[model samples]
Target chain A: MKVLALDTSNRPLSVSVLNYDKVLATTTITTQRKHAAYAMQTIEDLVKVAKLKPSDLDRVVVAQGPGSYTGLRVAVTIGKVLSDTLKIDLVGISSLLALSLNVEKEGQLVAPTFDARNDILFTGLYRITSNGPKSVLPDQHISFEEWLKQLDQFDESIVFVGEDVANFKARLQAHFGTNFKSVVGIDNLPQAARIGIYGEQQRPVSDIDTFVPDYLRLTQAESDWQKLHPGEGHESYVEQV
Target chain B: MKNENSLILSFETSCDETSVAVIKNGKEILSNIVATQIKSHQRFGGVVPEVASRHHIEQITICLNDALQKAGVTYSDLTGVAITYGPGLVGSLLVGITAAKVVAWAHQLPLIPVNHIAGHIYATNFDHPIEFPALALVVSGGHTELVWMPKEGEFKIIGETRDDAAGETYDKIGRVLGINYPAGPQVDQMAHLGHDTFAFPRAMEKNDNFDFSFSGLKSAFINTVHHADQINATLDKNDLATSFQQAVIDVLVSKAMRALDKYPAKEFILAGGVAANRGLRERLDQELEKRDVEFVKAPLKLCGDNAAMIGAAAEMLQRHGAKADMSLNANPGLEFEWAENEEE
Candidate 1:
């Protein structure tokens, strides 16, 4: 199956085209720019370099949420529209899981993180296996101090990956000591080629019309509303209004 | 793939509405579908940018599919894709821009970038062919402007609001009256049932320039209501509505008349969300009938943000060789370029 995969869930943007497991062409830009400005252009260029038309693709895989809210929408919106218009399958891969693909050691614990401001981080825990990275703990948005407390329970050597790990490197070293491992430079960035490979094993969304990025946290407005009206059903504030 | 009949697929998510439309030659709407988030924003008493963005991403593709299916057209039949790329919530605008760019790339169709305010002015194309040297009074929740167009594709801002927009003023005062969000239509309805007893101040009514200021009027209205509450006296809500509406209309109409006299346009257009006001529409129609200028009020249904109007504006823009590539990004503060040799 021919596939296109994209990730814009952070400052870095990646686009890749593959034929099954072989990546035909891929481009990853680490510099910060408006992802919305160059995401589709990069996809178009990569597809041409891969010598394929948009209609020739069989599926689209996108890195969906737990990062910048606007950045996640750029990729998800593009993925949803391309799949819908071309009548192809659409698969959403967890962004944190995709980052964990950088770890090659078997049975090693991998923690992928993104800074969520106010000392909060969007992070998750995954374990590497021969097949791929498997989620051990789900992705979540929590403060750095709280996340460190959760990691204290695990005794395995933990490898921290992601561009944002640099922000808390000292604190991580102080806590994990000899058990802490970190990957910097290129390996820390997300690779769309890895996303395409993992997505091939996942099921396509049953309803493309209602697909949305998994933003691990509620919007500030919704959180405030919930606090004001406690003990109420947590149904959609949109539907209730 | 250029179709014999020009068919443009357009997207508009500049504000709270996610609208998609297929236009035939820009004049006839094949199918326009709008999914509004007014109910969701009503709880917040105003639009929350984050909530609006969330709603837009969910509704965009749904509207696109419905629009194409209702129009009975496929990607192969489209000549181009157009989208609103400016003067709106950045998060909301990016959703439409990203979707439109993908459609254009997948179908190898030309991509057209349109300004949201231009889309409002072009809504009048459905009513009549806008004559050359047309003058437009554009008013909405976010904007109030007097735009002058010398020809089909040329635009210049002659005047605009110095403070709060006319619709924004209505909403602020409406909140004081305990009305729901977007109280323009309801406030307009109440104005017809009562006399103008409060005699609200009409700011910038006699100013030489076409610029408007509604902040003073908003402050005056708030002060009157708070004073009434302190004195243990009740002022009639209907009378307050009438007084506020009259003050707004007087300033808008007087400034519009002044602009028409200065520019001497062949046609006059009343455009944007506030254009749907019955009082403003009737007053402009009566006032314009006395002059040689032709009056054009946007169709009530098309006054709010919609893709049909964006497609209409894109047709004119395309004829003038306007196109954008995937590098286009939303400009949240975009405004009409001052007309050539007309900039102050």
Candidate 2:
């Protein structure tokens, strides 16, 4: 099965066409939130390098986010359209989990960090179990100090993943010293290929009829209402098809 | 191929709505599907960028299929793809751009880049074929600008809002009155019932150019309401809405007329969601007639945010040989440099 992968969930834009077990072509570009304009160009260049036509693709996959709002939206939006036009399945995968999936070390704990601004990180603790990378902690907004406290329990070497790690590298190194291993990920900050593999495993059907972005934050309006009204329960929307 | 027409699929996810449309020959709209996040944002009183983007992805496919099916055309039949490239919420723009890009690549069709403002002006082409070398006033929640298009597809902005747009002021005024968001339409409706007894100051009315400032009027409305509430004075919502809307209309109409006087253009195009204002349309039509200038306003549906306008602009762009080879980009800070001059 052929899979097309794309990610605009951060500063970097990434795309990959994977042939099930093998990668045909993968591309990553790091730019300032220019994903909407550059995303298609990157995809075209990749398609040309792979000697493939857009029609040849079997499925479309994209990184669903806990990352940049603009990046995630563009990636997922394109993913849905491509799958719909090609009459293929569509898949949405978590960007954080995808980052964890790219860790090279086989053992020990891995924590992927995403800068959530206001000095907070969209982060979670993970352990590479025999099955695969398994979550040790749920994704949540935590202060840098709080996260370091969570990581203090493990005496083993821990590998940090994600671009957010760079911003806090000094504090992290100062706290963990040599116990923490610092490494630069693949040139591209985003890993669209993981989205494809995850999509295949999840096998989400393209319901061009019904699909939406998975933004973890409440809309500004919702927040405004909540603040203005004070103590109103969050209204749940029964998404209509 | 000796084809007389080109089928263009257009997408607009620039704001609260995720819209898709199929335009044939620029003017004929086979289908226009809009999945509005209105309800989603109703409780919040405004659009949320994150939520808007999320909604765009979910509705992208449904909207695409609905348009194609309504147009009675398959993906293979499309000759080109068009998408709104700017002057909107960047995140929202990304969603539509991404979709348009993939369609362009998948179909191996030429990509057409469309300016949202250009599309709003082109919406006038929906009802009446516009005469060239005309002036267009684009007013919406996000924008308020006077543009001069000397020829087809070339846009130059002349005057614009220094603060809140005409629609933004409407929404702000509406909020103080407990009306739904986008109080522009509701206020317009209410204005018909009440007289302009309260004369809110019109900013920049005496300016030589068509520059506008709705923020002062907005603050004036808010302070008036707050003062009334503080002094325990009764206020009529409808009269207040009407009076406020009238203030905006007077200034808008006057400025539009001023533009007509300075530049003798073939047509006057009213664009953007605010163009749906009945008061503005009627006033402009009457005023433009006095000047003997042709007036073109987009159909009520096209006036608001939709992909059909994008398709319209794209059709003109394609006709002008402006083919985007996957190089089209989102320009959130998009501005018409030529618009700095009333006519160039």
Candidate 3:
């Protein structure tokens, strides 16, 4: 089975070609906002290198997001179109969960942290055993100290894996000291290869009709519109209990 | 299956509506469902992107199901997925992108990334097969441009909005006249009610190039309203509307005629949300007829943003053997692929 995976859920954009269960080629570009401009060419180059035509793929995978709203959309749109164009099934892996896949640990928790701005971090408390995380943490934006406090309650050494973790490292060391660790060097960032790895262990939704992006924050425009038109209440949110 | 007509499931959530459509053979729209957020944005006087994105999720499922039922097809019958990738609200674009990607993966289909403006332009394909080396004028809420296309799917922006877009000017004028936020439809309606009794400024009417600027005219209208209120002078709203609409129509028509006269193409395509303007369409038809140039315009009902248009554009990509993998991403500002290494 050929699976093409991409991670554009954060500031950086990553794409990879995976066959069966092995990674053949991976390209991750970390920049402020060049994902949309750079992603297609990179994918084309990867396809050329992999000797794959658009129709040879079996499934398209994307790192769905709880971070960078625009980045998330970039990954999702490309994945949808590629899978659709190639006649393949699509799999969506949580970008945060995908971040955890890069850290190889026997008994450590994979804690992925993304900068959410406004003094908040979009974080997930994860643990990677032989099995994936026993349970992925809630995807939410909370203060870094507040998040660390929540982590202190858990009874395990945590390995944080994400590029944004570097931004809060000093404070993180102050909190957990030797109790905390992170993905070494560039492995600290999200990679499409990792998203592919996570997608491998998960199941795709039975119907694409039920899927949606997990944008943790309401855009400022929506909030303003709500304020301007308070006359009628908003339609019910789509999330199911 | 290779010979089977490609089935494209397309989604458009760029603004104010959540739309889904299944197009078979590109020209035939099998099922198209759109959940309008007009009532939701009625109080805001304008679209709120955040609200639009949220609404898209709530509406995408019903739209998808309706498209499937209307098309008489299942995921098993699909060939590829298509979606409007950008040049719209960033938030609004994501909802469609997310759903389309997942379904594409579930069905193991190719993904086609569509430029929304291109989709609007391609909507003409439903009614007619366009020839090469054509000129397309894309006028909408967020954009206004004269794009030269030497062949299908290749676009070159020869001229564009220098300041406020034509649609934005219409909306702002509508606001001054106490009309709805998007003044295009209202202006079109009002233009029919009265004659152009007053002369409004047509900025750059003498310019040889196709570039447009509506800021000066819009400011003039707003200033007129404010000045009238201060001086206690009563201004006829309908006359003002007619006069303003006439000015816009004149400039647009004049520019289009100039483009037709030079670097002539066999056909002229009008596209984007603002293309629904009755005044503009009628004028284009009358003007283009004089030149004996073939004209293609999207159906009025399909003029605004929608998934069916995206499906139409996606069909061309499929014909070119373009395919997207799971990593296909949403591009808020993805320029229309005009030529190699050039983006509009």
Candidate 4:
């Protein structure tokens, strides 16, 4: 199976073409440039390097959100269009799970984090098993301090992964002391090759038309509105209007 | 797939609408599917950027599918892909751009990045073929500008709003009257019911430059309502609406007349969401007829943001060799590039 996988959920963008367990070509760029500007071109280049055309790909895999709203849309929109147009299988891998895949260790607790600004982080807990990174706690938008408080319950040594891990390393070390393991450098970045491999084992989205990134949090406007009308459940305001 | 026909798949998610269209040679719209978020934004009193973006992502693919199915064309039949890339909410614009770019890349088609204002002006093409040197008075919720097009695909802003857009002012004033968001249509309806009692000031009405300023007029309208409220005097809403509408129409018509005398365009185009105002359209039509200039009012249904207009504009841009690669990004503050030697 030929797979084209991409991750534009954060500042670092990764694109890869894979054939089953083999990574044909992969590129990861950590830059300040918007993912929208270079994501399609990066995918095209990686496909060319893999000696494959976009049509040759049987499945499109993407690291679906819990990251930057614009960044998530950039990848998800591309994924949706490509998959729909080419009539191929479309799979969405959790961005946090993709980040956790960088840790190859078996039976190690991993916490993948993306800095969501204003002291909030899009973080999740996962266990790196031989099969893949299994979700111990699903991805969520949370405060860094609050996330650490929740993590304090686990007695096992936690290996923190992701580029944003550097931002909170001091507090993490201060809290967990020697029990905290921060994986720095290239391993912290999301790998599309790993995402493609894992996604290959997953089921494709039943309906590509309704596929959307997992934003993992409500927009500030919605949150403010919900606060004012407490009993109104989290049903979309778009539908009500 | 790859037919001889010039079929273009277009997208317009610049603001509150998620629209997709199939244009044949940029003149005929086979299918133009517009999923509006007006009702969704009514609760917030205006479009929330994040909410708009969310709605756009959800509706883009659905619109694209409907557009293709309605047009009876597949990806292979499309020669190019076009999208509104600027002068809108960045988050909202990116959804369309991302989708367009992927379509272009996947099909190995030319990608045309269209300006939102340009799309509005070209919407007149659906009514009649635009004759050059055309003068377009573009008015909408986000913009108010006098665009001068010397020839096809060339855009230069001759005049513009110094403050709030004409439609934005209408919404702001409407909020004071307990009307819904997008107050232009409601205000227009009310204006026809009553006389212009207040005769609100027309800011920069006689200015040498074609620039407009509605902030002062907006403040004055607000003061009038507030003063009445303080005195417990309930002013007639129809009269208030009439007065405000007259003030806006007078300034717009006067400025258009002045521009027509100077530029001598064969066609004068009224476009954008505010262009749908009945009073403004009638006033411009009367004034343009007196000047013997051809008046091209964009089809009312096509006045608001839509992909059909973007598709129409893309045909003109493509003729001028306007194309973009995968690196194109949504420019929130994008404006028309000044025509050479036309910059003030």
**Number of the top-ranking candidate, with DockQ as the measure:** 4
Q: Single out the weakest 10-residue window by summed lDDT for candidate 2 chain A.
A: A232-241
lDDT per residue as tens, model 4, A1-241? 9999999999999999999989999999997558998898898888888899878899999999888889999889998989998899999989999999999889999999899898999999999888998999879999988998899899989999988888889989999998899886889999999899999999999899889999998888878877887887445544311
Q: CA lDDT, every prediction?
A: 0.91, 0.80, 0.78, 0.90
- Stretches of model 4 off by over 4 angstroms after superposition: A231-241, B1-3, B339-344
Candidate 4 docking classification: medium
Residue pairs clashing in model 2 are A8-A71, A211-B58, A212-B58, A221-B44, B156-B339, B157-B339
DockQ sort, best first = 4, 1, 2, 3
DockQ of 3: 0.14
Candidate 1: stretches off by over 4 Å:
A230-241, B340-344
- Model 1 TM-score relative to the real fold: 0.97
lDDT score at residue B86, model 2, on the 0-100 scale: 87
- CAPRI tier of model 1: medium
Give DockQ per model, in order: 0.57, 0.51, 0.14, 0.59
Residue-wise C-alpha lDDT for candidate 4, range B161-197, written one tens digit per residue: 9999999999999999999899999999999999999
User: Interface RMSD of candidate 3?
Assistant: 7.2
TM-score of chain A of each: 0.95, 0.84, 0.87, 0.94
Any idea how many clashes model 1 has? 0
Chain B, candidate 1: TM?
Answer: 0.97
